[model samples]
Target: MLKNVAVALVDGVTPFEFGIFCEVFGIDRGDQGLPVYDFAVCAAEEGPLTMADVGFTITPPFGLERLEEADLICLPADRRAPVRDDYPEPFLDVLRRAVDRGARVLSVCSGAFVLGAAGLLDGRRCTTHWLHAPALIRRYPAALVDPDVLYVDEGPVITAAGTASGIDACLHVVRQAHGAEVANTIARRMVVPPHRDGGQAQYIQRPLPRTACDTVGEVIGWTARHLDEEITVEQLAERAHMSPRTFARRFLQETGTTPYQWVLRQRVLLAQELLESTDDTVDAIAGRSGFGNAAALRHHFLRTLGTTPNAFRRAFRGPRAVA
Candidate 1:
């Protein structure tokens, strides 16, 4: 149903954020049996649009009029749009009209500010880059902002957190519009993960210890390659040449999560990959992903992703999987 797509660009547009939309929606991937969107980049007024910090400008062939017919409108991060009170009114008006007509809107990072300006984020659960989440909430107090997660989907409006999370949000849209197969295909071609767990918390950098030891880091690599085995803190401690308490402490300090939690998350990620890529039975996937059985896998899946495996498969597989 999402056949037509448009990226609404303004002055000071961040190239990476804008490129995210173009890579996801603008490319012609028909040869891969994927949906080819009628994509366009539209400028608010006309003429050359300036890029942020890149010392360059681009001429968008389409204007605001093109947005009226788009099934989806993407607003990429623009540094000025979020902070400036005088962002173009015509652009905001068109955004409101497009959503009023039942077209979905997606915002990557600070672009949520554009939706906030249009009053589209009011009464909707949304998010932006964690650094800007407080400002977004302060400006639009009516908006429910969750700063921890990578993205939030509030029906008509989808908002993604900083930077790379835009890929997850765009792939989610593709998965919803087409199927997991198409989304997975696109992800494979792009050489990125089809799904990512956890939140921007993991992305926040912390100063590393000045010491020359990275025992926990090596253990983490080993754990990833051996997810299917029953891994205990004692076993990992022995591997890391530390006591159980020390290993647990080091793991948390380095990974921001306990060893058990890290392993469980990895298991869930493996299960998700298997579910999306293979026709293996639930029990088989559970065994392979270290859940041991279908019931355990179901419990973890429900707790982590808030959906049953069968329902997730149905949503992604669409009509291709036999009931």
Candidate 2:
């Protein structure tokens, strides 16, 4: 039902989140029979806009006028930085008009700040980069900010956490409007996994560990490859040639979480992928994902994913297991 999609660009737009909007809506896949969106890369400003980094200049085809014609409006990360007080008033005005006219709106990552600035996110379930979550909540007490989730679809306004989560949010919109078959096809064409487990916090780049300089990184890579193995901090410390206390602190510094928590999160991610793409039973998936048993898998799954494995599989693959 969506025919027109417009992405609003301004000074300081993040290239990656902006790309998510373009890739999802701008591409014409008529030969492949995908539903088409009349995508327009428009600008609040009349001329060329500068990005955060040098060497990238975006020239928008339409002006603020495009906002009225848009069925869906995507606000990618803006340069105004999440904690800033002031932004271009004209840009905020355009966003306000689009929402007042019934266009579905989406904001990826810190773009939620833009929406918040426009007053569109008041009393809405929204998310932003986890690092900015506390600030957003503190600044705008009306917004319900959930930092632990991948994306939140609150009626006509959807907000995604971080940059790459924008991809998942867009694919989710396609899936809801079209179906999983079409969404999966688009994802395959893009050479990206159709869905990601957990939120962006899991992928947020952390400063590397200082103490376990020799082997911590290697251990992380190894743990990823051998997720099915029973691993412990002592074992990992031995591998890193550091004492347990030092390894734990350094690991937390490097990954932004305790080592055990990191491993559990990664295992959950692995299980999520298997659930989406394979016909493995819950018990089998539990074993393969290093959860040891179905009960343990269910405990972590509910705590982290907010759904049971069976429920997630059902949502992704329908009534029966994929064969």
Candidate 3:
């Protein structure tokens, strides 16, 4: 029954993240058999609103009234200037009322700050851009800031980390409300991966050189090709021609996660593929994905994905799937 999605934009909002919300939920993609969203751009105030470095202003059709009818309301990131004690009380009131009415609320990047200021995020698990997470936590200790994951879906509220992950979270919402098929079609249209494992740290300002010579692309490619084998941090370090400590530092800088964590995600991804596409048994899939056994695979999958392999496969490929 969910249809109308209202996005609340404020001054100095990050254009790309705001645009992603519109693209994912606002577009009328009914031609592809996708459900259409009754999308509207609403502002906390009336009149012209300036975007960052865009040299133009956008006039939103609805004001705070948009929140009253919104099935889902999105708060896009804004600059740090708006968080002072005197900031935007009327907007906060609207958000509080919308949430009270059981409308789903979402925030991308530092828009988490706005929700936090409104007290909507208190005692809730949330995430934001890693660069702003620590400060956000310090400013509002009541919020459970998790700077690690791409997004967290806690019942009626969802918060996505950083900018691009906003797309990932929005796609996830599509996947949840509709299904994976619809989400995948949208992702294909956008030319982005349907999912990116781990969190925003994995995509931050990587310390590795952008050029091939100074990067970990080759080594990572090699690791992916050999996930069935026992791989260790030391072995990966040797492959990169660096000591374990240095490699660990650089790996986190490049991938925003430890080598082991990266391997785990890839291994799970391989397991998921096997579950969906092959008639492999759970034991066989686990062995091929480097989980050693079915039990091990089940543990990690349930821990990270919140579902057992069997249930996930059944939901994706159908009940007849061997998982």
Candidate 4:
């Protein structure tokens, strides 16, 4: 259904963020049996657009009129997007009209600011890059901003966090349109993980202790390989040659989460993969993912993903797969 796509660019566009839109939607993947979108880059104004932080200019062949035909309109991050209070009214008006007519809109990083300028983010739950979250909130006070998650999807609008999370948001759109099999195939071609768990909290940098310790890292690798087996803080401590309390303390410092929390997240991730890729029953998947039973798995899955395992499978299972 998402056959037509357009990327609307203003001046000072970040090359990487702009390229993210191009990579996901603009590529010709028809040889691989993937959907090839009718994609175009539309300049928001007349004259060549300048690249941010780099001294170069690009002249897009398409103008704002091209956006009128797009099913999905993407806004990539630009340095001026968040800081500038005044945006081109004509550009903003086009975006407003596009959304009013049932077209979906997505923003990457600070690009959410453009949506904010268009009044599209008002009363919507959205997010921007973690570094820019406070600024986005200050500018658009009515927008509910969640800075920790990789992205926020609120029906017609999708906003992604800094940089690479754009890939996740774009892949999510593909998944919704086609199914997990198509999304996974594209992810495989891109050489990035099809799914990522937890939040940007794990990626936040923290100062490490002066003393070097590979014990926690080694235990984590072991636990991943042995996820089907029961693991506990005490057992992990024994393996690391440390007391349970000491192990827990170090784990929180190093991994930004407790041992149990990390293992549980990993199990849920495994279960999601199985649900998408295989025809395994809930009971079998639960056992393989270390939940031991379907009920426990269901509880965790719902708490983490806001959906049941069966419902998730029903939504994501490939069309060609047996029912």
Each prediction's TM-score versus the true structure = 0.64, 0.66, 0.64, 0.65
User: Mind sharing the TM-score for model 2?
Assistant: 0.66
- State which candidate, 3 or 4, has the greater lDDT: 4
Provide the overall lDDT of each model, using Cα atoms, as 2-decimal numbers. Answer: 0.86, 0.83, 0.82, 0.87
Model 4, C-alpha of 294: deviation from truth (Å): 24
Question: What is the lDDT for 14 in model 1?
Answer: 93
Model 2 bad stretches (over 4 Å): 204-298, 305-323
What are the per-model numbers of colliding residue pairs? 0, 0, 0, 0
CA lDDT, candidate 3, residue 277: 82
> What does candidate 3's lDDT look like per residue over 1-323, in tens digits?
56889999877777998899989998899988899988999987656888877788888988988788998999888875335444478989888888888888889988888888889888999999888887888888998988878888987789988888899889898898888999999999999989854455433432222323454677788888999999998998899898999988888887767889889888887887788889999999999999999999999887766568887788668767864
For this target, which candidate reaches the highest lDDT against the unseen true structure? 4
Q: Write the per-residue lDDT of candidate 4 for residues 208-315, one digit (tens) a residue.
A: 223246988888888888999989899999999999999999988988688898899888888888888888889999999999999999999878766678867775
Model 2 residue 79 lDDT score: 60
Candidate 1: tens digits of C-alpha lDDT, residues 248-274: 988887776888988987888787777
Give the residue spans of candidate 4 off by over 4 A.
Answer: 205-323
| Ranked candidates, highest lDDT first | 4, 1, 2, 3
Cα distance off (Å), candidate 2, residue 175: 1.5
Query: Candidate 2, residues 1-323: lDDT per residue as tens digits?
Result: 77899998877888999989889889999899998888898886656888877577878878888887888899888766665767678878877777777778998988888888888889998998887887899888899998887799987789998888899999998998889999999999999878865455433433333444547788888788888999999989998889999999989887668999889888888887888888888899999999999999999987887777877777667776542
lDDT of 2 at 24: 84
TM-score order, best first, reads: 2, 4, 1, 3
